[model samples]
Target: AQTVTQSQPEMSVQEAETVTLSCTYDTSENNYYLFWYKQPPSRQMILVIRQEAYKQQNATENRFSVNFQKAAKSFSLKISDSQLGDTAMYFCASARGNKLVFGAGTILRVKS
Candidate 1:
């Protein structure tokens, strides 16, 4: 079984600022992938970053970085230099082979 939780349901950030979105996951599988997905208003879901359960290094994509703590089962995303274009619904997901579980999501509004 796999489950994900996002403690913050909504978040706001100023332009050119930084924000962090936290996600915690629980999984019984030894090999799994943790991911942060973003879906803008009426837009398709896009991959923000991903971390393998077996990896010790966190994943980073441009201004987006993930703090993955395997022992604590925490995967948090830090967005630097946030822009209005960054406003979206961010989801924390965990996949164990064929099963995928998504968090309730955190809506991020980037204001000017």
Candidate 2:
């Protein structure tokens, strides 16, 4: 079984600053996929970034990036130059089959 863990329950960042959300997982499989999904107040899950276990380099999307530690089973998300629109509940997830296992989620509040 694969399980994702987000240590920080809540995070706050000032607009134009940077924030990093920590996440860790436990998995025995060698191949899998990790993802960070952001859900705003509207409750829409949006893909923030994704990283493949086989890939050595981290993934980046606009202001979002990931630090994937395969051996440690850790995958963290970094949001640079955070904006007000970035305020949302960030969830870390792992997917292998049709279903995805998600963490409890970290509430990110961006102050303008």
* Residue-by-residue lDDT tens digits, candidate 2, 7-108: 999999999999999999887778899999999999999998999999999999999999998988999999999999999999999985767899999999
Which candidate number has the best TM-score? 2
Cα-based TM-score, every candidate: 0.95, 0.96
Candidate 1 backbone collisions, by pair: none
Q: Please give the distance, in angstroms, between residue 64's alpha carbon in candidate 1 and its true position after superposition.
A: 0.6
RMSD of 1: 0.9
Candidate 1: which stretches are off by over 4 Å? none
Which tens-of-lDDT digit does each residue in 1-112 have in candidate 1?
5679999999999999999999999987777898999999978999989888898888889999999998898999999999999999999999978767999999999999
lDDT of each: 0.93, 0.94
